[model samples]
Target: MTKSARADMITVLAMQWNHRKVENLHKTLSMRFVKTTQKAQTEVDNLESLKQELNISLEDTEQWVLEVKQWAATDSNQTRHRKRRRLTELKKKLRERILQYNTIDTCTETIDTEAACSLSEDVILPWEAQGDMVNLRTKRRLFDQVMLVRRMEEEKVIIVKEMTQHCQNLRQALEKLDHLLHQTKDDIRNQSMFHKY
Candidate 1:
């Protein structure tokens, strides 16, 4: 073959080899770009999922706080009503005791000195026996009720404090999340505006 023809053939072969290398490089770069893009997209999706999870958790916590408040309020009202009723019953008992005392006083005034002297210290009056029994029972009942109410109030106070603290923490977390969301929205808006300009 002529030298000119041989040189031209070599140049053509080199050009073909360079073109193959460029094509391979382009394909590799394109694949890498696609893989990177998909990885970034997955990361974004994960972040979105995490945000949703956080939101759901906050909502559930807030709901629990609300339910606890409702329960506390209901229990408190019921306790108040029971206390009122107990007070009213005690008042009634007091009135009955006063009437019994007055009746006994009248009876004693009419009692002869001989009969009064015959009744020894061991010979208890019927009214005294009945009043003592009733008073003892009422006293025991009142003591038990008072203790129960005190315990319940203590529990209520503890629950209220815990709930208040939990609610406050939840509120702060929600506020922070809201603020972050707003900042993200503003950044996105600014980026869009920047792109437009």
Candidate 2:
């Protein structure tokens, strides 16, 4: 082969080798990222499971508290006994709920760590000159998605708050009705007693 041609061939070979090395490096990095992403996903699942359990516990506690309060206010032959029983049960349930909340908080800490790691995983390096524009675009897209998610979460919170308020109003109305009924009964009993005398 001519000297110039041989030199050209050597140059091409070096370029090919460099390209292969870059490709292999990218592959290695990609595999590592996938593993990290999977770990993050597992953490997310765990967090969700804990959150669901917490919600169930919260609902149960709320119902139990309501029942306890109702029993406390009830005027009946066994009111004292029922109130004591309810208070004892509520105390036990409250302790259990506190334990569950502690567990959930621990899980949340783990989730927060995992989330931080996951978010950092996709972060662009300042020195990444070639892909800065593309990275910026990607960040913008992710920001939009995050904003959308926040809006949805806010809407759900509003709905939940409205429902809770409505429930409270309903409970108050029922309590008022019960009070009026009790007053009427007492008034009738007093009148009957007076007439008998």
Candidate 3:
């Protein structure tokens, strides 16, 4: 074979290798994007469900408080004492739940942001500098994928923030309920003393 023909053969082989590498990298990146998106979606769903559950629990606690108030209207010192103890236990449980909710929200946000930023930053493939139309097309496609992943990350962040806000609101409500319970207990004690005098 002539020298020129041998050089051509070598060039062709190198191009084939580069094409295979680019293809493999693209597939790997696509799989990673899909997995990350699915995981984020699951986290958002779980947070929403947890928020709903917390709202229901808050309503139930409020109803319990109203019942205690009605029972207090009657002159039963023992019942008042028992209700006060139960309210304290409920307040403690609410505090624990609030802490867990805040911790989970922070963790989910950190993991999601880190994953998204890392993936987006590295999406500029080495093959992008090959200066061929084929590589150009591949680069464009990869860029679009990166944008989509970034958007998903932003959505996840928003959802986590909303969940955090809801948790804070619930915590405040519990604190208020605890304060009211303390007031009621004080009133009961005063009335009992008056009766004994």
Candidate 4:
């Protein structure tokens, strides 16, 4: 081959080699860019999914809050009614006790005698024995009155215990409501911050 032809051949080969290197670099950069775009799209999809999850959580929390409110109100009303009924029953029992005690006292007063019977009276009359029996019945009634009062007191204590338990349940429900509200608020705040980004 001629020297100039050889030089031309060398120049052509060099240009071809440089073109191949540029093509390889372009392919590598293009592949990297495509991979980066796919990764970004996946990240965006994950963010959307997170937002959807947060929305569902918020909705469920809201429903729970409403349910709790309804229950609290209903329970509160029921407790109030129960307490009032117990008080009324207790008052009636107290009045009954007072009436019975007064009756017993009156009978005792009538039975009291300042003077002893005359020695000529060898035995009590049958009607007087019946009166003594009636007095014994009054005393039994007085004993029943005390028992009733004690039973009423026990019932009052039971009512207090039940009321306290109900109040504690109410407090617990309120605490759950507060916790849910706080969690929802925090979720909303996080969502807002994510959107800002």
Candidate 5:
């Protein structure tokens, strides 16, 4: 072969090799990106599931608190004691759940921040650019949902506090009534004995 022709062949081969290397690198990066996205999505899904479970638990706790309030309103000492015990347990459970929710919220926030950072840093790859808008919308929706859950939890805490205060007031009223009844009974008994004498 002519020397120029041989040089041209070598140049073409070099270009082909370089092209293959770029293709392989792109493929590897694409796979890594896919895996990272999938993992983040799975974490989000798990957080959502946990939030649902916590909602169910909060509902149950509210119901129990209501029942305890009703029971405490009655004048029975035994029922009051039972109500207090149940309320304590419910409060403990609520505290734990709240802590768990806080932890989850932190995690959700971290994931969201990471996603936002990644989105900003991402170059406009053909595959990623196509879904960029969709991903942004989804992240916004997830953030909104998390905020809503946090608000709901805050409301639950307020409701519990109000219920506890009401129970305390009811107990105090019952005690005052009992004391007056005893005093009146004693006065009547002493007057009757004086009359008999």
Candidate 6:
């Protein structure tokens, strides 16, 4: 081969080799990114489900407290024995509900860890990569997907924090209700004793 032709062939081969290397690297990175995003998505989905359950639990607890308060207030007019029996039932329900809240609290504790998931930044954008080994449009789409997942993760954290606070508040409220129930029971017992005397 002529000297110039041989040099040109070598240069072309080198370019091809570099391009192939970039292509392989890009493919590997993309696969990794896909896996990461899917994992993040799954985590988000799980958190969303947990949040729904938490919301339901919160509402139920609040309503339950209100119902208990209203019932105790009205029960003073009822016979003492009937009031005592009703209060006993309410206390039993509260114990079961506290158990449910404990389960939800456990889920929330683990969820914070799940939200710790992060995306790998060791990727080359198609436009920034050597030899255009990847499609810019494809890379952009992947980047968009990553951004979307990141936003969802951020929102999930905010929601979880808010709900955590709500859960704490609800727990305090439940404690108050429990104390009020005890007070109500004491009042009922005293009324019975007063009537007997």
What C-alpha lDDT values do all the predictions have? 0.57, 0.56, 0.57, 0.55, 0.58, 0.57
Residue range 13-125, candidate 5, lDDT tens digits: 99999878654654554555565556556655655675465443545434544544454467388877887888767656655654554467444422232233243544332
Q: Name every residue pair that clashes in candidate 2.
A: none
Better candidate number, 3 or 4, judged by lDDT: 3
What is the C-alpha lDDT profile of model 3 across 1-197, one tens digit per residue?
A: 99999999999999999878654654554565566679767655554454364343445434544544454477367877987887667656655654554477444422233322243544432333354323223333433433455577876566556556656766897999999999999999999999999
**Candidate 4 lDDT, 101-186, residue by residue in tens:** 44674455332121212212343333456752323233333334334444555555555565566567668979999999999999
Candidate 2, 1-197: lDDT as tens digits: 99999999999999999878654654554555565556555654554454364353445434544554454467576887887788767656655654554477444422232322233545433234355233334334333433444555555555556556656766897999999999999999999999999
TM-score of each: 0.27, 0.32, 0.32, 0.32, 0.34, 0.29
Across residues 1-197, which tens digit of lDDT does each residue of candidate 6 receive? 99999999999999999878654654554555566567778865654454364344445434544555554466554567786787667656655654555477444432221121221234332224456343333434333444555776666565556556656766897999999999999999999999999
Candidate whose TM-score is highest: 5
Give the per-residue Cα lDDT of candidate 3 at 140.
39
> In model 6, where do residues sit more than 4 Å from their true spots?
1-39, 42-142
In model 1, the Cα lDDT at residue 66 comes to: 55
- Candidate 2 Cα outliers beyond 4 Å, as residue runs: 1-132, 135-138
| Candidate 6: 10-residue stretch with minimal lDDT | 110-119
Going through the candidates in the order shown, the clash numbers are 0, 0, 0, 0, 0, 0
Worst 10 contiguous positions by lDDT, candidate 2: 109-118
Regions more than 4 Å wrong, model 3:
1-131, 134-140
The pairs that clash in candidate 5 are none
